[model samples]
Target: MTDHLPRIVVGYDGSASAGAALDWAAEWAELQADEPHEVRAVIVGTAMDPVLGGYRARNDDLLERWRSEAEQRLAGTDTAPGQARERVEVRHGPVVPELLRAAEQAAMLVVGSDGHGLATGTLTGSVSQHVARHAGCPVVVVRPRRSTVANRIVVGIDESPEAGRALRFACRRAQRTGESVIAVHGCFSVLAHVLTFDGAESELAARSLAAGERLVQEVCAARAPDFPDVEIEPEAIPVRPGQVLVDASRAASLVVVGSRGRDAFAELLLGSVSQHVLHHAHCPVAIVR
Candidate 1:
């Protein structure tokens, strides 16, 4: 539901990642002692369609079972249980749409990575990605395989407002975990660059990419210079920003993305690609406004 403080909404479909997200969200929800927080466990149903391989998981009994399990999981892992304030929402609808809908009321959403999996294996699915693209708020894609505490915070920077927001948010998280922040700006050739590689345009593109990386580094250092206890390592990846961000997440605890607001972003704003990484990333993605 809506509140003055941010809430954590997680999409659950009996997947392990969802369970992990619930655990992580519960812990985070308790962090804001003064502010009210909520955690929702939503299950989205899919319509029968040939294109989607006609795969449909519709069982009221199963749904109830999952709900009980989620509650038990939350109860088990959540500390200071009696005093914490939050809600566990269980709704039925299209998974992605339901998540987006739940996101409408949440200041931030936390989801498990790879919600598509089996009894014991890596969960790699697209639900998180879908929500990241269309959610009304920032999304956090959690990696159940990793520890609840963050190892490192990774932010994709392009000197855009969204990216700046992501970096600042990431730094805050780093401060909480006493972890380092690796701000990465992925660079690569655009479609135009490929078309005009041999022309003068190629030179311009090279210069522009270089400048962008330098700017990302400069901004990261300026915005998050001294962590004292938490180390901040700003890095520049000379490849596609999304790819590099995804790669960075392989070893990171959290990945940050832009919320992709409707209004035009400022000079320091990040693009949709940052949003893209939120969905497909291997670790938790924190979207900053």
Candidate 2:
């Protein structure tokens, strides 16, 4: 099998959100690969110490139970689903670390918000946040698993090369699925993020808007001219790019953002706009490097 045949790895802790994510990943795996795609569902064992409860052997027992339940969950998801190869792994490590390790070999990592373990925030689930920040691969966060909504696909674009790569990925996926692409380039004055540049807010906003428009044009020019005739809309919303993208993601089928690269200011390798959208977007979010 080709190393890049597009496998989908999902995190599972038996939460509703995690189940939804697994279903989405299975569906995605079947759709993205012609050959049997790998759909590995990994369970991050509970952190609670069974030994403390006087059941020292219970740790392994609990993990075994989790694996069986996970397999059942996978079987339950097989409602006329595609023919992707399925795997269930039970590990006793931190959720995020395990997921990230799995992501190293997979094409994409799929996760859920508010899983068996989580608090709140965009990518509200701990696994979502950790993968978004640390994983070298892209992560798709699926939220509100029960909703049968066909939302649009949103991609955040800036002048960075990674952003361009992210836009292209989002557009291609949208075309295949007949989903709308909202290529949003969030723009605001540098003053918005920096206090020293306060006085030049108006001029900075103007510059940001202008740059955003130019970015849209550049995207069209650089990307395949006839790639599905994606409708390009240049946006100059005055807010942090991450915040703007998150807000725009409410009804999107997928939100795409660049990985926060070495350029901490823009290039997203992890824990950037893509991460936020992954959690906040009502649908799924893809992080591109």
Best by TM-score: 2
lDDT of 2 by residue, 1-289 (tens): 4243556788876677777888888776545544556778877664545447656476577667767876886776642234545578776555666677877867778887775442222223765767766778777777762235854777787767888888788877766576777777777656644643646555556776787777766775677475746655556566777788777766666778887622575534445566566556666677787
Report the C-alpha lDDT of model 1 over 36-55, residue by residue, as the tens digit. Answer: 46666666544423345323
All candidates' TM-scores? 0.73, 0.79
TM-score of 1: 0.73
Best by lDDT: 2
All candidates: CA RMSD in angstroms? 6.6, 4.8
Clashes of 1: 13
Measured with C-alpha atoms, the lDDT of residue 211 in candidate 1 is: 77
lDDT score for residue 127 of model 2: 57
Off by over 4 Å in 2: 1-5, 33-35, 46-58, 76-82, 117-124, 145-150, 190-204, 229-232, 261-271
What is the lDDT for 173 in model 1? 64
